[model samples]
Target: MNTPHTIVETTLVPHTAFEEATQRLEQCFSYADGASEPICIALVGESRTGKSRALEECFTRHAPIRQPDGLTTPILRVKTPSKPTVKSLAELMLRALADPRAYSGTENAKTSRLLKLMNESGVKMVMIDEFQHFYDKGSHKVMHHVADWLKVLVDDARVALVVAGLPTCRAVIDQNEQLAGRFLSPVFMPRFDWQDTDQREEFIAILGAFQESMGEAFDLPAFTGDEMAFRFYCATGGLIGYLTKFLRQAVWNAIDAKTTTIDLANLLRAHSEAIWAKDGPTGLPSPFDRRFSTAATDDLLARIKRIGIPAEEIRLPRSKAARQTGALGVQAVLTAR
Candidate 1:
């Protein structure tokens, strides 16, 4: 029986966009209730660039930026509303407020009630994710309305807004010039650029470091040259998320075979299975191409290699056969460099 070894949990990698966004996100939690003015931030990036993950971190952490005051900081996170209309948007706010008495009667009245709830709840920030749907499916009129409605919400609620979505979401915000002023900082997440040698090398170093770290637990060999790296770069356009998927798959295959070290053969086999990524392992691209991740590949892998994990040194089978044989205590994989 073969157990899947490729599946990794919480892969470690330095995603620049995610890192930069963390600082800006901290600002949202920094302000006190009604003490600071409103702020708005937009996350713009192509598919699979980790924009969603950056926004989702706040939700997963659930720790609001505490202010000088002892009061708990308030954070409201919501995805774009389905069937977004002035009415629906208002209702969405009401629901997220989780305050039953916040809204009542007609739309206008509900808006008033929602404003009251925001004030009453001391809500400091509102994060709307997947906001690009309106631009993708709705008309110009709908887009404009959503923009105007958001501005009004920001002013009335006196809370910051942090939105994350696809690059098309940029078009939606640009259309509403007023909205741009509201969100002065627009985070742009782009695919990894392989043309820059220094950048590529730095990324490689990170992966090498990681290899060292994991070496104690597993014998992952050093990745030499640009052959496989370039191949992965071409397929992923340097997208961190995509690169990780490819490398993880390769390592997984090597482990399953119980190979002493990862090599090009195992990598190719893994690439073939990554149909959504590079040309499949056999170098064939399927009709579909939709895969993504958030960490740069080379950089991430290098970091793994540098961690200097301790792996039990293996003796050559033939030479050691003259004596008793036994594999001993656990250790981490160490970096050759």
Candidate 2:
């Protein structure tokens, strides 16, 4: 019998796109003080595409500085509210700074306090995650007022801003001409493409890393195997986040069933219970089935593409959204710098 020495912690593999985006963000942060105008960058992608994970990694590298009098934060990261307004955004920052009176103020008063606190704290760069909330995707309405407020804040504060969220968030900035001009071209985090030769190679390399990390969790099917890799590509639709999840669940199933090695049955069980249950039953063919064909692959890919649309416009199974939020906790755990 074999068992893992340790559970798989949320592993952050610095893929190429993630590294490039981080470099761009670092440049923006470093350039803020000397530049005449404020620098802004956006990390846009679909959910589970590792945008938030990349930002979290960058944030940890530039952690707040502790001084004798008070803390001086060189980089401040805050989560945007689902319904973001000047007041709610202010409260988020205040709370992140550990201000005692985070919630007690009018919108104007809150904005004033936020700016004063930011300046006094010596914050040079601000990172806002889940920025898709800036617009009402369901209503197809842009929150132009909030966008205006953010533009003014950035100008007055003279700090660089890094915003990351689903691609829909791009509309929020695009709707405001000043913001559109200020935000440099967005860095997109894309999912794995099965059809691309290079992507397939890189993805297998990623899987190899996972195999190593699993230690003795039970021999996972070799990702290099043509059939095995195809099954994995089908199961996860090229989202590294989903790939980790499916593998994790399969390991757990093996453990509970006292199985010596993971097999096709274990994977199918995990897929239905862990991935499909939440992702909704779309009548997609199971990769484990003997009859599974390229037609099934095409259908699955189409569904994955639909998920990249604006968050509100896309309808998800209730459990799916909840599960996504839960999975984020694993991603939030930062790896070593």
Candidate 3:
């Protein structure tokens, strides 16, 4: 029997952008072998746009195989360490390859060991996530030396490289001429936009898929209708991560409350508990609130629109922001009209 938790956690609602990104990754993995030059790809997107998930799905298809000699790791995946240096990165890669002395080696020694292990483990493609870490957050500078090292490493190992991270990470490749020249066209995973007709429809379809999944366990309020879908968009800003977080919370809430159906009241409570912490409140009205008006909703959507791609520039509207002044200010701005 599948619990609501299992249903929500396991269900991956396919949308257009996500599907396209997956296809691109598959193509990269498939053609990695028998290529003269090292194949490279960049998967860049804002946080919570499913960049990591897409990589994981592709990784699953090429699972590691165990043979008489040793385990064959076809694809090596590692997250970039915060404030990554060449030494730290080499060590991290060694650790992923199960090196006993991953932290004990000198930089050159680690690099040598990494290459040997890559050959030994049969690693053909290297996938690095959280690649934005290559950019210094405080100084706003790209780690050029490290990027250069990676370029050389890929070239020497003769393995395909895929780096996934925030859109800002594009600078990591763009700034390095050698690296940029080696990469195929970048793959972008962006949040759904309400203003775009196709995106809006896809967002609704995603909600419908989630609703169907949850419906298997408990009756969920209609989430596919335009008006209701718009409300959900306001709540999650059309980011699949936020939407899944919100729905996961609703599922748990339903279980705890001993309810068979997730109603608007349940969603209101879930929004409060899941979307934002009680400590910090955004002044904005809860999209799930019965009293939340169209004007307020539009006001919220407008604010979300301002959060353009490369979401780092303007942080997503948080509950804390809502608790402070924006919520009341939005109401004040709306009420005056």
Candidate 4:
């Protein structure tokens, strides 16, 4: 089975949005070191649009610097708890700092330890992914207490705060004017635009890059072919994360079935089984059927290849509502008195 090999070959594909986000993060990282006040920046996007990945890439670039004094983490990254409470948030930070006794204290105690560790560890920046957890959507409440706590902690520490989360995170940040004012303009990582001439070429180039990276290993199908590329884009709704996911599964399926090549059929089956199997019908046309091909698809592809079109007039596919990444429970946020 090509399982082991295929798993190793799966890698991050750098497209336009990812690259741009990385550049902005680099600037943020540099600005954190000497800023007079704590710097805040929000990385906002739909789930699976690479917000977390971009933050992670920046974190990796500026890893902990070990010295005789101690290990100095330049960028401390952690994910918010699934159920966000003041206690849980403190515990998350403590755990990320490698404190064994992360869960051993009251909320106030944990908060003290969190701040102490951040200073002692020489943490210059903090990155919290899935930050939207701080807001409870079902109850329509913002965790004002937690937000105030964070604002105080960051100000005291004087470290940059890099928060990445879903679009809903904007609401959480907006509720606190003091917290919201600290943040620089948010960097939005949008999905690929199929109708935009430059974006389409860049998207296709990303597909070509993936094929070049993995094609020879498995005798993969022509992913960059005009029709195949359009189909892949449609299947993935132009999200690189989904595109990579679909391709990875298709590769594994090809290997397990002892097939020599990945074809449209393999991809179609992979789509139905993996991507949207549980979501039910999306009311969108299937990209797999030959009869599903239309003049609209052709014209879109034509515009993409030619890179000639009125930028304002070109009609692109509308984005579907953002999918929930996990099941949210019946919970309420603690508002500040």
Best-fitting candidate, scored by TM-score: 3
Estimate, for each residue in 40-73, the C-alpha lDDT of model 3 and write its tens digit: 9988888778899999988889878999998899
Ranking by lDDT: 3, 2, 4, 1
Model 1 spans with C-alpha error above 4 angstroms:
1-9, 31-36, 58-73, 81-83, 86-121, 137-142, 209-217, 246-266, 275-337
lDDT of 3 at 77: 90
**List of clashing residue pairs for candidate 4:** none
Structural similarity to truth (TM-score) of each candidate: 0.64, 0.82, 0.87, 0.82
Q: What is the lDDT of candidate 1?
A: 0.62
lDDT of 2 by residue, 84-185 (tens): 888888898988877889999999888888889888888888899999898896688988888898889889899999999888899898888889999899
Misplaced by over 4 Å in model 3 are 277-282, 295-299, 306-337
The residue pairs in collision within model 2 are none
Instruction: In model 1, state the lDDT of residue 307.
Output: 19
The C-alpha lDDT values of all candidates are 0.62, 0.78, 0.84, 0.76
- The clash tally of candidate 4 reads 0
Sliding window of 10 residues with minimal summed lDDT for model 1: 327-336
Model 1 compared with the native: what TM-score? 0.64
